[model samples]
Target: MRKADLLDELRAEIGAMSDKYSSELEKLYQFVCNSLFDNMADYQWVSIYLVEDFSFCLKFERGQTELPPVIPFGEGFMSLAAARGSVVRERIWNRTEVYVPFYHGHHLVGVLVVTGTAGGNIDDEDISLFCELASLFESKVKKCNS
Candidate 1:
């Protein structure tokens, strides 16, 4: 599909979602993974990592058996997103990495990482959608923490 079309579709999907419950956030994460898998068709793994105590912890994951242990906010792609406060994309020999930062007001919350086969690439649209989703997740987390 065209990049614009993919982005529009993602925006529509995200707009339809309601982040009123934690379960809804889980569903959103699953939806993102499924959408990425369907659209790109080369992802081996997709996961959501949230900030906790200045670290990024795996919250949900798909297509992977084991994930790295809790990661600090200054390490890995997740940390890169948090540190840069922006989306980071890179292509590896066997995998593609994408990280989108989550923000709560001015505070950095966490990041969402999507990894796919080398043939698949993460585009600007994917990064935007991931950041939007992360913002929703951050909002929900803030409400719960309050």
Candidate 2:
């Protein structure tokens, strides 16, 4: 499916999910991650890191490999995105990665980390879509808390 159509479908699914299952934020995170990986070929994995005290904890992930459970607020791409309040992109271990920070009413809530498939580079379009998805997740988080 095209990117726009995919995003529309995602939004619809998320809305239905919210109506049907008023679960925790982590469940929503996992659903988004899994959906992105399953629908977007460029992405191999996705994870959500939430700010916890002095560190950003890995709250949910869906991928082939596991990420560290905890990372300092200033460390790594995801942490840096949260700290800087902007998107961060980098290439490491032969894969392109993007980290988009999630904010809820000016409060930095978490970061969404997306990694490209092996041997492939993440393009700007993919990054933009991931960022949009992060924003959707952020809105969902805000609604749940409100």
Candidate 3:
């Protein structure tokens, strides 16, 4: 499917899911991660890192391999994206990692991280779709937090 259509589908799914999984953000995160991985075959994995105190914990991940459960603040690509306060895309050896941070006011809520195979570097259109997904997730998070 084209990126635009896929995003529209995801937006609708997330909207319905926001109602169904309102109290369990982790389940919602897992669903989004799974949806992205299943819909976009090129991805190596999709995961969400939620901010807890001073660290980012692996909330939910959908992929072939297990990811680190905890990532310290100010470290790794997660930190880089958080510090930059925007989407950060980097080519890490054989993969392209995109980090999308979600914030509520000035407080960090979490991050949505998607990594795809090296050749699948995201262009402007792809990144825009991702940013939209992150925004959708962010709205849900904000509603729950409030």
Clash number for every model?
A: 0, 0, 0
> Which sections of candidate 2 miss by over 4 Å?
1-12, 15-23
Total clashes for model 2:
0
lDDT head-to-head 1 vs 2, winner: 2
Best-to-worst ranking by lDDT: 3, 2, 1
Q: Write the per-residue lDDT of candidate 3 for residues 105-131, one digit (tens) a residue.
A: 788889988888657655666677678
Question: What lDDT score belongs to each candidate, Candidate 1 first?
Answer: 0.70, 0.77, 0.81
Candidate 1 per-residue lDDT over residues 10-113, each given as its tens digit: 67766666443355566776676666666655566777777789788887776762448598767777777777888888776756788788777778766777
* Candidate 2, residue 146: how far the Cα is off, in Å: 2.2
After superposition, the stretches of candidate 3 with alpha carbons farther than 4 Å from their true spots are 65-67
Candidate 1: deviation at residue 87, Å?
A: 1.0
| Top-TM-score structure, candidate number | 3
lDDT per residue (tens digit) for residues 20-136 in model 2: 645467677778788877877777788888888988888778776446889887677776777677889988888888889988888888888888887875777677777777777
Which portions of model 1 show Cα errors greater than 4 Å? 1-3, 19-23, 65-67, 138-146
Q: Could you tell me which residue pairs clash in candidate 2?
A: none
Please give the RMSD to the true structure for each candidate, in Å: 3.1, 2.4, 2.1
- lDDT accuracy of residue 129 in candidate 1: 71
